[model samples]
Target: MPYVPPPDLATLSLPEIAALVAARKLPPVEQWQPQAVSDSLMVIKADGRWFHDGGEIRRPAMVRTFASLLWRDQAGQHWLVTPFEKQAIAVEDAAFIATDVSEQDGALAFRLNTDEIVLAGPDNPLTARGDAETPALYLLVRHGVEARINRSTWLQLVELAGDDLCLTSQGARFSLVPSA
Candidate 1:
């Protein structure tokens, strides 16, 4: 069967987005305790480019598949996990990039570079880093992995934010401006 992308966020209500989020199945990387740990020689750049052994992984589907297997440990190390082994991967800034964003039923929805849709909520809250002068925003994708909000998406979020430069979704509030 051909791949069918999720419906546009603009047409989906908050409940529908939640249902979509719940219906998606991801690899059980967290449950795997692979004794074999090695380097995958994979790098995810801050700009969201994926490379392997110095060659760019240009296929979106391949990237998405790899991304589904990603797991970030408590020490902030990234790894591609499987039931048999775990391979480390370098992440320059964030594991994924938020390429687009939209608002629906008072909730914010984000589209990642891998074409995955994420909703900002208690389980996937938004965070800010750096100083107020150069703030960087991120959204928790899954299993401790985050997606850096790109410049264009950040601008769109800012436009949707209140005068206090804060955005709220699913009862969780985030300040876009970093603290001093």
Candidate 2:
């Protein structure tokens, strides 16, 4: 079997979330309704440096990562749009996809729109520009673990920790820590 992501998130409280997930009160694909003080379509991290492995100096880059966000809202499904502006940001996104290259042809591979992609820039994120602290909800895609990225050329990723899929965006790694 392969990895599958959930499709729903219910409520946004940390402890309650943990409990519901642990107790299996929610389904694998439950909708998490979280209230954000800002926007949820985008999340940008502070500026950082992307360096070469051999002590070489590349241009510094920032971080832009998002998860379970809706960029486009259509009749039922929405089209995602990424806001990454730097080549470096694209590079990192591509790398993440590259690592998860799927040999199942196109059957298992996937592409991320804005929900799973982020870009970095020189300036800091303003309130209106949108940051990770924005209001957003989670919709667990209750399908078999599938490759969330494709092509591996320019990708955006937010690898979160999964304690039953408790996704936290405001963190060093923005990882989804298991909600035990």
TM-scores vs. true structure, each candidate = 0.95, 0.19
Q: What would the TM-score be for candidate 2 when compared with the true structure?
A: 0.19
Candidate 1, residue 178: how far the Cα is off, in Å: 0.7
Residue 120, candidate 2: Cα error in Å is: 27
Task: Please identify model 2 stretches exceeding 4 Å from their true place.
Answer: 1-30, 39-98, 109-180
Tens digit per residue, CA lDDT, model 2, 94-170: 12221221112111122223222121111111011123353122222222111122323212223222444232232
Tell me, by TM-score, which candidate is best. Answer: 1
> What lDDT tens digits, residue by residue, belong to model 1 across residues 1-180?
567778777788878887887898998887899999999999999999999999999988899899999999899999999999999999999999998888987689998988799999888999999998899999999878999999999999999999999988988999999877
In candidate 2, where is summed lDDT lowest over 10 consecutive residues? 119-128
lDDT of 1 at 101: 89
For model 2 the local lDDT of residue 77 reads 26
